[model samples]
Target chain A: MSLAELIEQRRFVGREFLVWLWFESELFEGRFSLDALGACELWLEGQITLVQEKEQSRLKGAAPSSAPEAHEALRQGKLPSQARVRVTRGELEYAFLFNADAFALAGVKIPSVVKDAADEQFYERMYLIEELETLFTALYGEFLALRLSAAWETGVAPFVRAWVRGEPVDVAAYQKLRGKLAPVRGAARSRTTPPPAQAPERAARVVA
Target chain B: MGALKGSISFSKFYVRGELPDGFRDRFAERIQLRAFRPLTVEEDAEQRAGWCSIENPLDCELDHGKIFFNSYLNLGLRTDRWQVPSALFKAHFAEAEREHLAKRGREKLGRREKEELRAVVSRKLRAQLMPVMKVVDLSWNLEAGVVRFWNQSPRAHEGLAELFEDTFELDLVPESPYTAARELGLTSEQLAAFEVLKPTVFHAESTLGGAR
Candidate 1:
C-alpha cells in the first residue's frame, strides 16, 4: 500500500492502543513497570471521549473512563478517540489530552518548573516533554509487542473482551500470559522477532 | 506562550532528508526571503503566510539570532487574510449596486457589472479594515529531526508542510500511528503489520440488549 493509504488505514491501531491502555491500567491498578522507566503510573482521568462515527459519549470527572456510560459506549462499537491521561514516574508527572488518530498532544501540563533562567527553562521543559514521550512510547511499544503476536488473539483479546463486558477477569492467567509476552531482550519489540508459537493459559484481573 | 514557556499544545512531525553543510547560514538567508509581507489593497492575494519572530509576531526581519536557539530552530508561522464580514459586504454591495444603477440610469445590472461592483466594494472595505492575523510557533530539533508545531488544525499542518518544504527543501511526515510507530524503530515487518491489523470490536460483537 502507498504510505498515505497505509497510514490512513491503520488509524485504528492507535485507537486500539488506547483501549489496551485503558484495560491494562485497570488490570495493573494504574502502575506499570517498564524497561526504561522502571516503575511508573498512568491512568485515564478527566475528560474521556468514546466515539463511533456520529455517535459519541463525552464523560467528565476524576475518573471518566470508569463510568458505566464509557463502557456502554465501548460496548456499542465505539472506541476512545481522545482522552485526558495522567502519567507519573518517580517525582515527575505529566498530564495531557492524547489524540488517538493523530498521535498529537494538547493541553500538556508538564511537571513544575525547576530552572529559573529563560533558556534553561526552555531546555528543562523540552526535556520533561521528551521524557514523557519516551515513557509513553515505551508503554506503546509494550502494547505493540503484544498486539503483533499470536498472543493477542490467544491471550489478550479474550481478557479485553471480558473486561469490556464488566465481567471479572482471572488474575493468574493474565499475569502468566503477560510474563510470556514480554519483549525479548537485545531486539526490537516489533515484527523483527519471530512471533510466539502459542499462547499459554491467560487471565485478567480488572481493577475497575 | 510557545516552546519557550507556559503550557504546551502541539502536533509533532518527523523531518526527512539530511541537512546539508552550512544549513544554519542557508536557513537564515531563506527565512528572510520567506518572511511575512504585509497585505495591501493593490495585491490580489487574499491571504499570505510566512515566517516571523516567535517572540514578536510583528518582527518579520528574521535573522540568525531569532531563528536559532542552541540546538533548536524556532520561528512563527504567521498568516494574514483580508476578509470582509459577509453581512457588511452584502450591505456595502447593495449600496454600491444601487448607486451604480442610479448613475447608469438602469433598473437592473448585468452579471459583469455586479461582479465589478463587488470587487469595488471589497477594495473600499479593505482600505477601512486590516487583515486578520494569526501566528503559530514552530520549533524544530535539528538533531532529532522532529518538528513541533503549535497549531494542530489541518490547515496549519498543510501550511507548515508546504512552507517547510519550500523553505528547507525537506519533506515532513506528520506524526500518525504509522509514522510514530516507525519512529519507535518498528521493523519493516512490524510496519507492514500496521496495514494488516483490523480494529478490535471488543464487547461490541455481542451486545447486551441488541445490535447497536
Candidate 2:
C-alpha cells in the first residue's frame, strides 16, 4: 500500500490509542510509573471531544472524561478524537489538548521555567515538552505492544469492555496481563495472531 | 513561532534521510541563502514564505550562532502577503479607473484595461501600506530528528515543509499513528500489525449512545 493509503487507513489506531490510554489511566487510578520518568499522574481534564462520523460531543469541565455523557458517547460508538490532558510529576504540571488522530499536542501549558536567562528558558521549555512527549510515547508504545499481542484479545479488550459497560474489573488481573507486555522497542518475538472472531469487542460495535 | 513566548501550539514532523558529513556549514549557508526577504510593491507575487531568525523575525540575517542552541537548530518561518482590503481596494481602484479614463477621454475601461489600472492603483496604495506578516518558529532537535513547527495550520505546515525541504535537503513526515509508532521504536512485527489494526469497541453489547 502507498504510504498515504496506509496512513489514511490506519487513522483509527490514533483514536484507539487514546481510548487505551484512558482505559489504563482510569484502571491504574492515574498513578503511572514508566521506565523513563519514574512516577507521574496523568488524566483527562478540562475538555474532551468524541466523534463517530458526523456526530460529535464536545464536553468541557474539570473532568469530562469521567462524565456519564462520555461513557454514553462511548457506548454509542464514539471515540475520543481530542482531549485536554493534565500530567503532573512532583512539583511540575503540564496540561494540553491532545489531538488523538494526529497525535499532536496543542495549547500546551508547561511547568513554569524558573531560569533567569532567555536561552535557559528556551532549553527548559524544550526539555519539558520532550518530557511530556516521552510520557506520551511510553504509553503509546505500551499500547501498541499490547494491541498487537494475543493478550489484547484474551485479556485487555474484555477488561475494557467491562469498564465501558460500567462493570467492576479485577485490577490485579489487569496488572498481571500488563506485566506480560514486552517493551515496544525490543526484538520482535513471534506470536500467533488469534482469529478476529475470538475477540468480540474488536468485531462488534455498540449500536445506537 | 513560540520558542520564546506565546500560548504553545504546534504540529510535529519527523525528519527522514541522513544529513551529509559536514552538515552545519552547508546547512547554515543554505539557511542564509533562503532567509526571509521583505516584499516589494513592484513584485507580482502576493506572498512569500522563507526562513528568518527565530529570535527576531525582523532580523533576517541568519548565522550558525543564531540558528543553533545546544542540540537544537531553530529558525522562523515568516510569511509576508499583500492583503489589500477589498472595500478599500475597490474604492481606490474606482478612483484610479475614473482618473485614467477621464485622462484618456474614454467613457468606459475594457476588462484588460481595468485589470491593469487596478494593478497600478494597488501598487500606488501598497507603497503607503505594509504587507500582512506572520512568523512561526521552527525548532529542530538534531539528535532526535524531530521538527516542532510552532503552528498547526495546514497552510503553515505546507509552507514550512516546502521551505524546509528546499533549504535542508531532507523530507519531513508529520507525526501520525504509524510514524509515531516507528519513532517509538516498534518491532518489525508490531509495525506490520500497525498496518491492519482495526478500531476497538469498548462496549460491544451496548447500543450506540445507550447510556444516555
Candidate 3:
C-alpha cells in the first residue's frame, strides 16, 4: 500500500489514542507516574469536542475534563476530536488544543519565555517548543508501552470496558495494571514536586 | 526564514529516500524563475506553481545544510458571460453587431463565433487581472530526514506534499502516533497489540489548577 493509504488506514489510532488518554487522565485522576519521568498531570481544559461522524453529531463541552457530560458523550460512542489540554510537570505548565486527526497542536501556550539577553530569544523559543514536544513524546511512549504489554488484555482492558459501559469498575484491578506499567524510555527523572491532590468529588465521578 | 524566531506552528514529516545526484545544484536550477512571458489565453488551463528560495531572492542556492523556500501557486478565472450586466452587454452587443455588419457585411453571428469573441474579450480582461497568490514555507533538513511545513491546513498540506514529491522525488510521511509506533520497530505481536488497544478511562482525582 502507498504511504498515504497507510496513513489513512491508521488515522483511527490517533483518535483512539486521544480517547485513551482521556480515559487514563480520568482513571488515574490526572496524575500518571511514568517509570522515570516522575509524576505528571494532564487535564482536559478550555473546550472539548467529541464527534460521532457516523451519527453526524458532535458534543461540545467547555467544562473541565472531569465533566460528566463529556463522559456521557463517550458512553454514547463519540471520540474526542479536539480538546484543549494542559500538561503540568514540576512547576511548569503547557497548554494547547490538540487535533487528533492531524496530530497537530495548535494555539500552544508554553510557560512564559523569560530571557534577559536579546540574542537568546530565538534559542529560548526553540527550547520551549522542544520541551513541550518532549513532554508529549514521553506521554505517548508511556501509552505505547502499556498498550502493547501482555497485561493490557488481561488487566487494563476489562476495567476500561466496565467503565465505558457505565458499570461499576474494579479499582483494585485497575491499580494492579497501573502498578505494572514501566517508565517510558528516556523519561526525565528529576521532577521534585509532589503529585497534585485530587478533590473528593473528582473521585466520586468514577463511582457516579 | 532567517533564524527560527517566534512561536512556530508547523507539521512534521519523516522524509524518505536518499538525495538524488547533484541534488543541491539541480534544486537551485529548478527553482529559478524565468523571465515574464504572458500566457496564451487560448489555453483554458495553466498552472502557475513553482518553488523559489526565500533567502536568496536574486539567486537560488542551498548555501548550508538547511534550505528554506516558498512554494508559490497562482490560479486565475474569468467572469462568466451570464454574470455580466445583461442590459449593458445587450446594448453593447447590438452596437458591436451593427458595426460588424457595416464593416464586413455580415448578418447574425453563429453561437460558436459569438462564444469565440466572448472568450477573446474575457482573456483580454483577465490579462489585466492577477492569479490568486499562495505562499507557504518549507524547511528541509536533508541529513536529518525531517521537513517542517508552515501550513497545516488540508488543502495546503496536499499542495505541499505534491510539490515536495515533484521537487525532491521523495515520499514524506506525516509522523502521527501510528507512524511513530511503526518507527519504534516493535515485534509482530507488539504491533498486533498496538492495533487492538482500546481507550482506558483513568479515574485520577481533580485539582489540576489547585495548589498541591
Candidate 4:
C-alpha cells in the first residue's frame, strides 16, 4: 500500500491519536500548514535515506578503496569470490551491499502484509502526523527488541562463555556470531574509564 | 535513486527455560547510555527563538533512545543481530522507490501511472526466477545490482532455484553458487569473521533548557 493510504488508515484512534493531537497542537499551536507537514514528510524520508546510505556503505566489500577493486572486478567479469551470509530469526528480510572489510545492512522493505496494515492506519485523525511519529518510535524500539532477542538466542550466549573462560576463540567463528559484540570490543578497548553506573530501570530495559 | 530497498524476514524460536548466566547483566550493560551535559539555555534560545518558544526550560527533555546493533558470523550460518520492523521497512522502501523514480525523471507521472509502473517493475522482477524460500537477508549494492538476496536457508535454496527456473523460464544455477561467489569476495578471511556491532545508540537526556 502507498504511504498516504497507510497514514490515512492508522490515524490514531481514541486516546492515542488524541494525545498525539494534543501534543502536536501544543507544539505547532494551530500554525500547522500543509507545507510544514510536507516538510516533515521530507525530513522523515531524508532520515530513511541517510540510514540506507550508511548501511550500503558499510557492507563488506563496499569500502572506499575496494570500490575500485569491485569495479575492476566487475569490469574484468570476475564475479565476487566471497559471499557473506546473514541469518536472523523471524520473517524479516534485509538488503545489503558488501565490501571486503564491511557490509552495510542497507535498507529494509517490509512485506505487503505489514505495509498494508501500516498504510491502512496511516492517517485517520487530524493529528495523524503526530501519531505517526509515535508509531515510528515504537516501531524502532520493536526492531531493537527483535535484534537483541535474536542475538541472545544465536550468538551472545556462545560468545560470553568463550570470553569469560579466556578460551582461544576462533576470531573468525566469533565474527560469524551476531549482535553488537564485535564493535563493543572496540568500544570497550578505546575506553580508559569504566562505564558509568547504570540505573536499575535503564539496565532492565536493556536486558529485557 | 540511491535509496535502498528490501524486506526483513525472521523466524521465532523458543529456548527452554533455565536462564543463561550473566545474560541479563550483559544486556543491561549494553543498553545503558552515558550521560552528557544538557545544552545550555543560551544555545537553545539562539536556535529556536522564532520557531518555538519554551515557557519552562527545566521541564523540557529530549528522548533519543534508538538502539542499533550488528554482528559478525561464519560464512554459511545465520546470525540474529537486529530485526527491522515491517512498518519502517515499507516506509523506507516506498520513500526510496519514490526518490529513485524522481531521480530518473519519472516524478511527473500521474499517481495511477506511478502505481502502474511500480506494479509492472515489481512483477517483472519477481518473475525473474525462484520462489523465495527463506530470505536470509536483503541488501542493496550501490555499485552493482540494486538488490541481492542470499539464499542460505535450505528451504530458500531449494525453493528459489526451482521458482526461478519455472517463473523466468531460464536456466538458473543453484542458490549456493551465488553464495559461494559472495564468500569468495571476502578473501581476507573477513567474511568468516562476522562481527555484530552497534550502529547507533539513542538516549533521552533530561535537559535544563527549553527550546526558546
Native contacts recovered, in order, as a fraction for each?
A: 0.47, 0.53, 0.15, 0.03
| Best candidate (score: DockQ) | 2
Candidate 3 positional error at B149, Å: 1.9
Candidate 2 iRMSD, 1 decimal: 15.3
DockQ of each: 0.25, 0.25, 0.11, 0.03
Ranking according to DockQ, highest score first: 2, 1, 3, 4
What are the interface RMSDs of all the models? Answer: 14.3, 15.3, 16.5, 26.0
- lDDT, residue B1, model 1: 57
Give candidate 4 regions above 4 Å deviation. Answer: A1-96, A112-208, B1-33, B41-212
Indicate the worst ten consecutive residues by lDDT in candidate 1 chain A.
A192-201
State which docking tier applies to candidate 2.
Answer: acceptable
lDDT of each: 0.81, 0.80, 0.58, 0.26
Q: Rank the candidates by lDDT, best first.
A: 1, 2, 3, 4
**TM-score of candidate 4 chain B vs. the reference:** 0.18
Between candidates 2 and 3, the one scoring higher on DockQ is 2
* Residue lDDT tens for model 4, B33-141: 2111232222211111100001112211212111111110001111111223447546655765687677888756667866765554444433443222111322211
TM-scores of chain B, in order: 0.90, 0.93, 0.58, 0.18
Give the number of the best model, judged by lDDT: 1
Interface RMSD of 3: 16.5
What is the DockQ (computed on Cα atoms) for candidate 1? Answer: 0.25
Expressed as tens digits, the lDDT of each residue in A1-208 for candidate 3 is: 5556666666666666687677778766788775655778987888877777755234445645567777777777777888888899897789888878777777777777675442244335444655666677667767667677877655565565556655565666566667777634444422121122210111111110
Q: Global CA lDDT of candidate 2, please? A: 0.80
* Residue-level lDDT tens digits of model 4 in A3-105: 2333233221111211222222233332222211121211111111111222322123323212343333322322221222221113322222222111122
Candidate 2 runs further than 4 Å off: A186-208, B206-212
3 or 4: which has the higher lDDT? 3
